[model samples]
Target: MTRFIEIRNGRVVTPSCVIEDGRVVIAGERIVRIDRAAPPSTRSETVVDADGRVVMPGLVDLHGDDIEEQFAPRSGAETDPTTALATADRMNVLHGVTTKFHALAFEESPEDGRNLENAARLARAVDRGAGALGDNRVHARCELADASADAVAALIEEVDVDLVSVMHHAPGGGQYDAESFERHYVEDRNWPAEAARSAAEERSGMDDASQGQRIDRIGELARRVGVPLASHDDKGRDDVETMAAHGAAISEYPLTLDAARRAKALGLATVMGAPNLVRGGSLWDNLSARKAIEAGVLDALCSDYHPASLLAAPFVDTGESLSTRVNRVTRNPADIAGLPDRGRIEVGARADLVIVDPSPTPTVERAFVAGSEVIRASAGSGAAPELPARSRTR
Candidate 1:
């Protein structure tokens, strides 16, 4: 029972390409052939003419935070994990993100950690056929500062954690400058003002001696579990060197140019936030994504907080064209994650693809996973496959 889908006359985008008048042949759940012009056979079951549209590989988001969005839908209202996850999945697919890594960080707060556990359970549930939504993966973004060595080791064993990022959010340092630090712990995240103040004060009280011990403990546990490690917002060359010593394979948004250079030199793939790229700069005082790309210091772009941002980043600086930007989100992240067969359009690669139209505004027309059409453009607009007004990618 072999089925075929011929994407005729579309611009095919791949990891190492942008092909005009391209054709893709899908056999069941995998891409069997991709060429400028694929000949049709009597055995072919379907043929689709894209009418000169842009077709590309689906986006791969290494770090996404839709759980936080669903949890705090409006100020204090909290959506249940199941509902939130379902919503997040639809949002991702409609926006063209085929592969997403949910950054389920363990908070020291019991309530927050419990919420993460629920989210983790939900991810496993969906992955195990609880629902047919989207490709949702759970990546445990561990807070080294809040977790003990034993707690971290236990978490790895407890959950089917995919990526274990070594994060140290020391108030007033790295990503959070003093003012922003106060906002995260004291105001925005709903931490009790007084408690947040006290915790920040206590952390500041620690000398390099105690801080080093804590860092080492978490690093040791992460290494023991053999999870991929990432250094968060490395500050300078010294910080990059320290991360390299710990066998960090990715540099997640180094804050300084020197740190970015050092990370690249040490062989760590540099990842920047897609939101930053579309917004034209970092939310915090960090490296500009466009500048990083121009300098060749960036390797991959993650959705970070907004899944749709992955689709928009490639279009922001149109000089590179849509295919090139699409690769930044797909092939780059897959390669960094060590997944070779899923990010590109080639023989034997998984048939994960997105059909988009770069018309008045770039938008995803339809999406497929394992050769199954998972989402199609909303018919209400009649705008020829444009992103719905209320649909969110970020």
Candidate 2:
């Protein structure tokens, strides 16, 4: 935290607007100065020429499925925690994500490589690996179907987290109807058609009262831990209201416009996956993120499962100002996460920023976290890959 860095000749995205060809000065970990005119070259500061790049606040991603994927790049294959974090941290910094919340889903989906033990290991890795290139925090995504309230609390005591979310991933429940739920198991998870169908039918008959009790207990635990609580894949206004009554401060991925509107009405921050905006719509066809943005119901965008999408969303021409879109990934999410010091290009804010090359598809040219240059793109080191172009992205 004892460094000084200077970046000049950049299109700096400020809180309210873009400052064309501006300069930002960082001292230690906070932004010290910002101006349109160039400051004279100095000896104490390491100066970087932006070369007409876009300079903006580093992203504050609330959810991404990266750590698990990094820890197990291949199915049935695993790596050590340190190696996994090193890879995830590198990928995050290269994509302009300075503060990333590893969404650790506590489910028994072994086919997709998630279990209670695996979640704990990943949480411990992030907990132990402090001072990574970018900030890493845990988001405990507890599936009420598989985890008891006591088990969820026990895991929270084992390792601290940045936020918590509760959900039920069953047919006729969160994120799915009977057909889509069964289809997801069959198509995505490779479950047998009959088994998936049978599972869906079984889930539909579960006791709602029992599920509500689990939600209350988890909500209490989140309140005790003093982190933001979120409800995931909400499908209706009633779902939004029910979660909000339990102190849920954020609503992640509301499946309908009515649900999003209700979340916003209930003063819950509404988050949608960035990939939905990038790929034109939701992959599962719940609610269109672009539609949410246009309806002015969405509060922020999460990476969901794609870190690249967060970097790409702010510049995707959503008919909003660049500042507005940038804040959706930066300021809004940071605010929701109770991080007031980062996610803005303002004096006295943490100097977490990224400089991007946006012409041929956005690429992180340089990234700074808390006044430290964690990543700087160079030809000698090989160019970072461009944003992926595919139909089924994320």
The best candidate in terms of lDDT: 2
lDDT string, candidate 2, 1-394, tens digits: 3567888899999879998989898988889889984765574458888878899999999999888888877667888877887678778878899888989888776665677878888888887664477888889888887764666678777777788899788977877878888778878766668867766776677697987888888899888989999999999999999999889999999999999999999899999999999999989878999999889999999999889999999989988999999999999999999999999999999989999988778888878777767777773367654332111100
Quote each prediction's TM-score.
Answer: 0.88, 0.93
Clashes of each: 4, 0
Off by over 4 Å in 2: 41-43, 192-202, 379-394
Per-residue lDDT for 1-394 in model 1, tens only?
A: 8788877788888767788999898998799888887666556677767778778888888888776677556555666666677678778877788777777665454423334454455455434423444566666666655654455466556555556566666676677765677678656666666766666676567676665676666667656766677778888888888878767788898898888989999999999998888888987768988888888798889988887788877778647765567778888898887677787888898888988776566678888777877776753477544332222121
Error of 1 at 335 (Å): 0.8
Clashes of 2: 0
RMSD of each: 4.2, 4.7
lDDT, candidate 1, equals 0.73
- The C-alpha local distance difference test score for the whole of candidate 2 amounts to 0.84
